[model samples]
Target: MNVFVSLLRTGVPALGGWLVALAARHGLHIDGDAVAGVLTPTAVFLYYTVFRFAEEHVSPRFGWLLGYARPPEYKALPA
Candidate 1:
């Protein structure tokens, strides 16, 4: 399950960025690498935005997409 979720989480956004580059190549005159360079960060931002929301407001299960099926380790500083 975690593997599937991880794959989807990675594959979808990457596919989206590639698709954008494809569309831009068809319509615009810009280079594909440049378009991907711009869209990659946008895709990542959007991915985090959506999944973070799902993880918080929707269900804890969504955390699987973000690789935190449970909370992280807690470390207290020395007194």
Candidate 2:
């Protein structure tokens, strides 16, 4: 699933956006494409950057917030 759909499915994270979109539709009015084109990348970058910092400085447990229940172990290939 794309980030927008995933965020919606996950709940809370996308709620604000949906609320804004609803308001904009009935009141302000903006193109859906305009919002989606900018929002997806911004959200992806912001979420990853913030959560990655938290995982490094605060606690590894924060990894779950990024969808990893357990951090993946890095393994080097055998030569």
Candidate 3:
């Protein structure tokens, strides 16, 4: 399940690129290169944001699936 989600996250940009190319080929009057330039950053930010949200929200179940190990408890030093 986590692996599938990981693949989906990684696939969004490539899928966006393909969709952009499809639009370009259909007389959409959009520049594929420019669209890809915009999408790259957007995809990266979206990926990170979703990753963090999932890490915080669904972490207990998805944690090990994504190779994240819970950190060992630490004692605070006296101030």
Candidate 4:
């Protein structure tokens, strides 16, 4: 389950980035490395935003789908 979750978290962004890069290369006539340079950070930013949102708003069971582990509740914290 963890492995699946991990893959989902990484694979989607990777594939999206690749597609974006490809589109930039072919459709926009951008260079390969330049397209990657632009899209890489964009993809990372998007992934971080999505996962953080999920961690805050979604159930812990589903939060793993975005690669977040829920923090312990207040009752579980040490004094």
On residues 1-79, what C-alpha lDDT tens digit does candidate 1 reach at each position? Answer: 5456566666655665566556665776778678778876676667667876887898989767655563344457899
| TM-score of every candidate relative to the true structure | 0.56, 0.57, 0.41, 0.47
Clashing pairs in 4: none
User: Who is ahead in TM-score, 3 or 4?
Assistant: 4
CA lDDT scores, all candidates in order: 0.66, 0.57, 0.53, 0.62
Cα lDDT tens digits for candidate 3, 2-78: 55555654555445545545554466457766766676566556544555467678775433333343322345789
Q: After superposition, how far is residue 67 of candidate 3 from its true place, in Å?
A: 7.8
The Cα error of candidate 1 at residue 44, in Å, is 0.6
Clashes of 3: 0
Report how far off residue 49 is in candidate 1 (Å).
1.5
Highest-scoring model, lDDT: 1
In model 3, what lDDT does residue 16 have? 51
Per-residue error for 24 in candidate 1, Å, reads 7.6
lDDT of 2: 0.57
Instruction: For model 4, state the Cα shift of residue 27 in Å.
Output: 5.2
| lDDT score, candidate 4 | 0.62
Q: Candidate 3, clashing residue pairs?
A: none
Clashes of each: 0, 0, 0, 0
TM-score-based ranking, best first? 2, 1, 4, 3
